[model samples]
Target: MKGTIHKCLAALVKEEYGEDAWKKCLQSSGFEPERNFALTEDIEEENSINLIVESAKVLDIPLKKLFDQFGVYWCCTYAPKHYSFWYVGMKDAKAFIIKLDEIHGLVGKHFNNAKPPRFLYHWTDKNQKVLKVEYQSNRKLIDLYISLVNGLAIYFKEEIEINKISEHEVELTFDY
Candidate 1:
C-alpha cells in the first residue's frame, strides 16, 4: 500500500476522531507513534491492515465503514487537496475514473516502490450508460472500491447506480 493512502486515513481519523486516537492507531499499527509518512513511500501491507484494525477499535466503528469512508475521503477530499497535480488534466470524475490505470502506471513510473491496484473498464451497455469495472487487487477491498466509485460520482454530481457483479467486479449505470 502507498503511504499517501495511510496518511489520508490517518488524517481522517485525526480530523474526525481525535489526535490521540490517531496516535494510538499508529502505535498499534506498528508504525512509529509520531511518524510522518511520505507521499510516495510504500507502506507495509501488514502495517496498513493493522492500522485499519486499530482504527476500527479506537473509533468504535466497523472496519467496513472505515474502509469505505476512507475511500470516499481519499477521492473526494484528500486527493483533490494534496494531489491536485496528479489530477491536472483529469478534472471530472469520469475522466479520472477511466484513466485510473494510466494514472497508476504513471505513479509506478515515478515511484518504483508503489504498488497500485489494477483497474479495467468495460463498457457493458453503451446506450444506457452502464459500465463494468474490474478491480483487481490482492487486498480484499471491494467495499472500498464501491465507495470510491460512489464518491467519484458524487464529486461530479452524477446520479449513478452501482451493482456488485462479483467480489472483484462492479457495474455502474448512469446517464452520460
Candidate 2:
C-alpha cells in the first residue's frame, strides 16, 4: 500500500477521533507512530491492514465501517492532492467509476507496484439506471469498494441506493 494512504488515514483519524488514537494505531501496527507519512513511501500491505483493524477496535466501530469511511475520505479528500486530474470535469458517479481502471493505469505509470484492482461496470437491468460492479483484487477490500460507490454518488450529488450482493459484486440503483 502507498504510505500516502496511511498518511491520509492518520489525518482522518486525528480529525474524527484524536491524535492519541492515531498514534496508538500506528504503534499497534509496528509503525513508528509518526503522525505524518511521506506520500511516495511504500509500506507492507499487512501493516496498513493492521492499522485499520486496530483503529476500528479503538474507535469502537465495526471494521467494515472503518473501511467504508476511509474509502470516502480517500476519494473525496486524499486523491485530490495527488490525482486531481481524475476528478476534473467528472459530472457523475458512473463516469467517475468507469474511469477507475484507466486512472489506476495512470497511477501505475508513476508509482511502481501500484497493484490497483480491476473494476468492470455493467448494467444488471436494461433501464441503465441500475449498475453492477465486478470488483477483483487480491486485497479484496470489498467494503471499501462499496463505500467508494456511495461516496462517488455523494460527490456527484446523486441519490443512489447500493446493494452488496456478494463479496465480489455490488448492485447500485441510482434514484436520479
Candidate 3:
C-alpha cells in the first residue's frame, strides 16, 4: 500500500471527524497520533488495514460507510487537488474509468514497490452504455472500488447503476 492512501485517510478523518478523533484512531491503531505518512512512501498493508479498521471504530461508523466516504473524498476532493495532471482532458467518468489501469501503471513507476490494483474493461452493451469492470488485485478491496466508482459518477455528474457480479467483478450500467 502507498503512504498516499494513509495520508488521504488521515486527511479525511481529520477534516470530517476533527483532529481529536483522528488522534484517537491513531492511538487505538497503535500508531503515534503525530505520525505523518509521506505521499511516496510505501506503507505496510497490515498497518493500512489496521488504521482503517481502527478509524471506523473510533469514529463510530461502519466499515462500509467509512470506505464509501473515503472513496468519494479521494476521488472528488483529494486526488483532484493533489494529482490534477491525471484529470487533464478527462471529459467524463467513463473516460477516467477506462484509463485507470494505464494511470496506475504510470503511478506505480514513480513509487518503490508499488502494486496498485489493475482494471480490465469490457463493453457489455451494443450501445456502449454498459461496462463490466474486472478488478484484479490481491488485496480484495472490492467494496472500496465500488464506492470509488460511485464517487467517479458523482465527480462527472453522471448516474450509474452498479451490479456486483462476483467478489472481483462489477457490471456498470451508465445512464448518460
**Which of the numbered candidates is closest to the native, going by highest TM-score?**
3
Better of 2 and 3 by TM-score: 3
Worst 10 residues of 3 by lDDT: 104-113
For every candidate, C-alpha RMSD to the true structure in Å: 1.8, 1.7, 0.9
Candidate 1 lDDT for residue 5? 82
Alpha-carbon deviation at 160 in model 3, angstroms: 0.9
* Model 2 per-residue lDDT tens digits across residues 6-67: 88788789888898888888887777776568787787888877887888887889987887
lDDT of 2: 0.80
The weakest ten consecutive residues by lDDT in model 1 span 86-95
lDDT score, candidate 3, position 85: 94
Candidate 1 structure quality by residue, lDDT tens digits, 9-45: 8788888888988888888767787988778787788
Candidate 1 local accuracy as lDDT? 0.81
Which regions in candidate 2 have their CA more than 4 angstroms from the true location? none
Per-candidate clashes, comma-separated: 0, 0, 0
Query: Candidates' lDDT values, in order?
Result: 0.81, 0.80, 0.91
Stretches of candidate 1 off by over 4 Å are 89-91
What pairs collide in candidate 1? none
Against the true structure, what is each candidate's TM-score?
Answer: 0.90, 0.90, 0.97
Model 3 residue 172 CA deviation (Å) reads: 0.7
